[model samples]
Target: MPQSVDRALDVLDAVAASDGPVPAKALARRLGCGLSTVYELLGTLTARGHLVRTPAGYVLGYRVPSLHLAFQRQMRMSGEVQELLHRTRRAAGVDTYFSTYRDGGIAVLAAATASHPATGGFTVGQDTTGHATAHGKVLLAALPRAARLRYLAASGMRAITPHTITSPERLDVQLRRVRHEGVAVEVEECAPGVACVAVPVPAAGAPTAVSAALPLEEFHRRGHQVAEALRQVAAEAATFQGTADISGSTGG
Candidate 1:
C-alpha cells in the first residue's frame, strides 16, 4: 500500500481508539511519525471529511458514519435470521450476539438486545480476545489446531478481566471442552459482572457462533436455559436461506 494512504488510516485508527478528540502531537507520538507528516495526513483526511478538526483536536467526521452505515447494510441479516436472534433474546432474557470468524478475527455480525437497556454496549466490529469471550471461544474452537495457535499468537491473550484465561495451556483445555460439548461458557471473563454462553451455528458457509450475555448471577442461575435457547436459535438460523457469512479464510 501507498505510504500516504497507510498513514492516513493509522491516524483514523488512533483517533477512533482515543477516548475523546486528540491533538496532532499525540497522534504523531502514537503513530511514531513526524509532526509535519501527521499534519499533512490530518489536513488531507480533514478535507476528505474522514476527520474533523475540533477546538480540542481531531475526531472522526461525518464520512465515517456513512461508511459505518454502508458496512451495516452490507452485513445486514435476513428477516429470518433477525427473527431468530430476537427469539433467542426473548427466550433467554438477555442480549444476544451473532458472530463469525472473519479476516483472522471474531466479527460480531449482528446483535439483538433487550427492549430496555442492557449492561454492556455491543460494538459491531472485530473482537480481539478469542481467549476471553464465549463467542470468541466458539469461533476459535472451530479452527484447526495450527490455525488456532497462529491466531492466538497474533492476538495475545490479554486479561480483560481478572477471570480471563491468560495461559495458553488453560485456554487450550477450555477450547477442547467447547468442541466436545458444542458450547462455550464464560463467567465474568470479558467484563467484570457479565457472563455469556455461546453455541456454534452449524451453517454451511461461514463458521458462526450465537451467544447470550447477562449478569453473572443470572447466568449461574439459568445458564443451561440460556445455552439451550442459543443452540435452538442457531439451529434455526442455519436453515435460513440468506444467513449472513461474515467470514474469511481461516488461514494461519
Candidate 2:
C-alpha cells in the first residue's frame, strides 16, 4: 500500500478504537507522525466523509455505518451459527445476543428475539457499559489484570442500576468468577427487572460473548435452564472464528 494510504488507515483505526472522539494532536502522537501529516490526512478523510472533525475532535463519519452494514450483509453467517442462535432463542424462550468487546466497550453483533419479547432492551450494534452487563463482564474478565483495572478506572465504575457493581474490588472478584466458571450472570445490573447470562467466545478474538436475556422472574425460576442453553450456544460459537476476518476484509 502507498504510505499515505497506510497512514490514513492508521488514523481511521485509531479513531475507531477510541472510546470517544480523538483530537488531531493525539492522533499524531499515537501514530508517531508529524502534526502536519496528521492534519492533512484528517482533512482528506473528513472531505471524503470518512471522518467528521469537530472542535472536540475527529470521529467516525456517517459513511462508516453504511459501510458496516454493507460488510455485514456481505459477511452473512454460516448456516450453523445462525441456526444455533435461532434454536437457542427458541429453546430458551428469550432474546439471544451475540456481542463482542471492541475498542474498550461492548458491541452487540446480532440478536434473535423470542416470539413473546421480554423487556431486556437490547439490540444489534448497541454499545453497552463494560461493568454492568453479563456480556461485558465476560469481555472484561478476559482482559489482563492491568487492562481490566485501567478500563474500570476509565469507566468510573458508574452504576447503571441499583444492582450494578460500582466498586472495582467487588467487580474484580466477579470477573475472576466469570473466568473460573466460564460464564457471567447479571441480575438487573444493566437494566432494572432484566437479567442476563453470558459466556465467552474467544475464538472470535477480543473477548466476544453470547448471552440470553429474560425477565427477572423467569430468570429466578429457571436460571439453570437459561444458563445451560446459553452455554451450549456459546460453546458452538467458540468454535467459530470467521467474524473478525469478515469485518476486517473490507478495511483499507
Candidate 3:
C-alpha cells in the first residue's frame, strides 16, 4: 500500500506532469485519488514550495528555480569542476580531481595530473566506491543527513582499507569531524600509498559537492599551500558564468 507521504508526493507528481497548474478537483481526478487526499497533498507540496497555482491552474512553484539550480549544478560541475582540478594539479604538481556522489557511490568525473616523481595521470570516467576514496569521503561527509543515511544503507559498511571505517557509527564520527573541519582525509582507504585530502563544493541553489583527491607525502608537505590555491580557485570558479551555485553555500 502507498504511504501517506508517498501519496502526497504522487499528488505533486500528477500536478507537475500537468500542462499547467490544475485546480484541486481536476487534480484529484487526474491522480485517481479522492478530493480530500489530493487537497491535503497539494497543500503539503505547496507549503514545501515545490508546487504552485496560478489563474489558470496548479503548476510547478516559483522555486522551480531551485530545481533548475540543481540541474545546473550537475552541468556546471561537469565543465567548471575540471578547471579547479587543473588549477590544483598545476599549482601543486599533484594529481587532483572532482568526484560527485552517484547511485550510493562516488563518480570521478574529471581529474588533472601533475608529474610527481614522474607519475602518470588519471583519466575521465573513472568511477570508484565512495567508501574507498578521499574524494568520496569528503562527498560523504557533506551529504545531507537523509542522503547520507540512504548511501550508508545501500552501500553497507565494508572495509576497503585498513583505514576505512567499517561501521556506520565510526564513519559517522569521522564525517562529523569532516563537517566541522571542512575537510576530509584518507591515509590508505583508496590506495595504500596514496593519501588524499578533500573539501566540499556547496550547491546552495543547485546540486552541490565536495572536491578532493591528492597524493599523501606532497600533500602533507605543501597541503596548506595547495589548499589555499585550491580555495582561491574554487571561489573564482564558483563565480563562473553565473552558473556556480553560491546559493548552495556552505559557510566558510
lDDT string for model 2 (1-252, tens) is 599999999999899878688999999999999999999999999998899988899999998887866644555434456567788877768888877655555567777886433356675664647788888888888877766766677667777888889988899899989999988999988888889998876556456788888889999999888888887787777675554332321011
Best by lDDT: 1
TM-score of each: 0.73, 0.64, 0.57
Question: Candidate 3, overall lDDT?
Answer: 0.62
**Sort by lDDT, top down from the best:** 1, 2, 3
Task: Output the better candidate (1/2) by TM-score.
Answer: 1
Best by TM-score: 1
Comparing 2 and 3 by TM-score, which wins? Answer: 2
Q: Sum up the clashes in candidate 2.
A: 0
Sort by TM-score, best first: what order?
1, 2, 3
Clashing pairs in 2: none
Give per-candidate clash totals: 0, 0, 13
Residue 212 in candidate 3 has what lDDT? 43
Is candidate 2 or 3 superior in lDDT? Answer: 2
